[model samples]
Target: MLLAHDDEGSGPAVVLLHAGVADRRMWDAITPALAHTFRVIRPDLRGFGETPMPAEEYADADDVDALLASLGVTDAAVVGSSFGGRVAMELAMLHPARVSSLVLLCAAYRGLEPTESVRTFGAEEDRLLEAGDVGGAVDLNVRTFLGPEAGVAARELLTQMQRRAFDVQIAADQAVPGPAPRRVEVDPTAIAVPTLTVSGAHDLDHFRSVARHLAEQIPGAEHVELEWAGHLPAMERPDAVLALLLDVLRDDPTVHAP
Candidate 1:
């Protein structure tokens, strides 16, 4: 399938993948800085943004590989947020040669088993969406995914983005049916690529858990926690996130240094 993408800058290739509810547009805050040093390729994932879905059930890794191939990118470092991070993990495992490195933010992995809060929230959101209460779904998403300190304007923008995300999913003929689920188990030790896992200090506990798991299990993997941020640190703390990303790309030994 042909994927929709936005490419910028001119240097070593780097692909930025967005979270499930957000499209490639989520990278708008930090892409400019990254573009200064690398060729940035941002693609709207299937059922999200302008990207149309494939005819058959296709893994996200396959879509990513196809996208890079189409762009004539033989190798690249990948930066993925949330759902996109999960896809990056799969790509690192399935096609390590194409991926030069990996950076994951507020990524979800581990397993399908959810905590009590996650379960309750998921059920409620599903019920609201099923009852045609899209507004409620948007509100719940904003409150849950974003930090409480987020400004009203930011929350509204998030809601709008979510609405557009839902519309895109609905428009896709091959969108995944039913509720989105997580992997049963993710063995970071199986990943061969150099990896960097990042999480917001105020993010849900699951993200921290995943980051810790990756840091400990994946060889040479590094983990960083951003204070005063939640699930979307790249949005909430763009400067810090960009600095960390650049340090990782430059292979700086002391990334946390001020």
Candidate 2:
């Protein structure tokens, strides 16, 4: 399937892959600015946004390639947050010819051991679900993902998105062909595309490790930790994140013509 997406603007393409906690709407805050100079495509990953959870086994990277191909885009810069970031890396490794650049935000990778706080939060969230406390689970996400200093609006936005996710995936049932097999672990060194890894200064240690590892493993990949942000820096500080994105895009050799 092509997947539900918002495609706009015109120029060298730039796809916005959203965080796991939120969907395509998560890019609403900054899409307008991005649209001025780039063809921005934001898609709701399978089972996440307006897209229905499928009953068959599927590769997300395949879905992404399908979406881009359907749009006639041969290559583009990809920016992703959290799980979306993981997807971005997979795209670069699997379809190097189609990825011009990568901008990853707090992306997790295979064999990534969660930090103590993340582990605690995950167990607590699972317990909440088992206890049928959806609201409580949403609250837990706000506290766990958003930093302590995050303002009320950020908290509320996260609460709304998290609750929406529960309303969709939790309320629905999905069946895979069999056991949901994990994709082969991507070889980071195989990603020759220019990459930028961004994390929040206040983000979880697990994601911090992700940013560091990506930078160290992917030759010439840039890494930065934005101040006053947590896991979802795009939402918490959209302007700052947008500026960084513009900087990377403008300087990318792939983005400019020879």
Candidate 3:
């Protein structure tokens, strides 16, 4: 199915996939900036934002590829944050010809084992959700994902986005039956496109490790760590991340600086 998306601008396609904690709106700060130079496509993946959860089993990577195909786009730069980054990698792996390049921001890798901090965070999130304290869960997410750099506005926006996500996902869980969506294993070494893996120093060790692994495994993939960022750098510092994205897209993708 074609996931709900916003398509703007008139140049090479640049798809912005948001973090798991956020929806397409997560790119609200940088979309307009990037759209000035590229065909910016931002999709609200299933069960997020404008896209409702699917009743049938489906893969997010397939949904994204289909969305692009419907838009008449064959290849484009794919940028993803957190879980969205994992889907971006899957897209590049499954639909190799459709992705010109990849930019992973605190990307989630299926191969890595969760760190202790990550496990604890998950447990707490689960407990809160099980107790039906969605507000608590949302607060937990904001605290964990956003860093010291996040302003009040950004934090508020994240709270809204994440809460909406939980509401949609929870409603779907009650209605939809049978297992969750499955992910395809991504082999970083097989990804041939120019790739950039970004990690935040303040992020959990699990994500940092994933970033390093991607950079090392994916040929020519450049890894950059943001000293001031947490998991959602795009939301934390849109200007800085936007500049980094433009630089990577306009110049040599393999070359970058933090």
Better of 1 and 3 by lDDT: 3
Tell me, by lDDT, which candidate is best: 3
Instruction: Give model 1's clash tally.
Output: 0
True-structure lDDT of candidate 2: 0.83
Deviation (Å) of 37 in candidate 3:
0.8
lDDT of 2 by residue, 99-135 (tens): 9999998887875678898888889999998898999
Give each model a TM-score: 0.90, 0.91, 0.97
RMSD of 1: 2.9
Ranking by lDDT: 3, 2, 1
How many pairs collide in each candidate, listed in order? 0, 0, 0
Clash pairs (backbone) in predicted model 1: none
lDDT, candidate 3, residue 104?
A: 98
Indicate the residue-level lDDT of 72 in model 2: 96
For model 2, what is the error of residue 232's alpha carbon versus the real structure, in angstroms, after optimal superposition? 0.6
Kindly report which residue pairs in candidate 2 clash with one another: none
Report the C-alpha displacement of residue 50, candidate 1, in angstroms: 0.6
lDDT of 1 by residue, 1-258 (tens): 767899999999999988876788778878998999999999988777787554456667877888898889998999888888888888787677789999988887855456677778889989998898888888888888887556665666677778888776655533556334223235687878888888887888777777777788889897878777788776666677788889988889887542
What is residue 86's positional error in candidate 1, in angstroms? Answer: 0.4
C-alpha lDDT (0 to 100) for residue 36 of candidate 1: 99
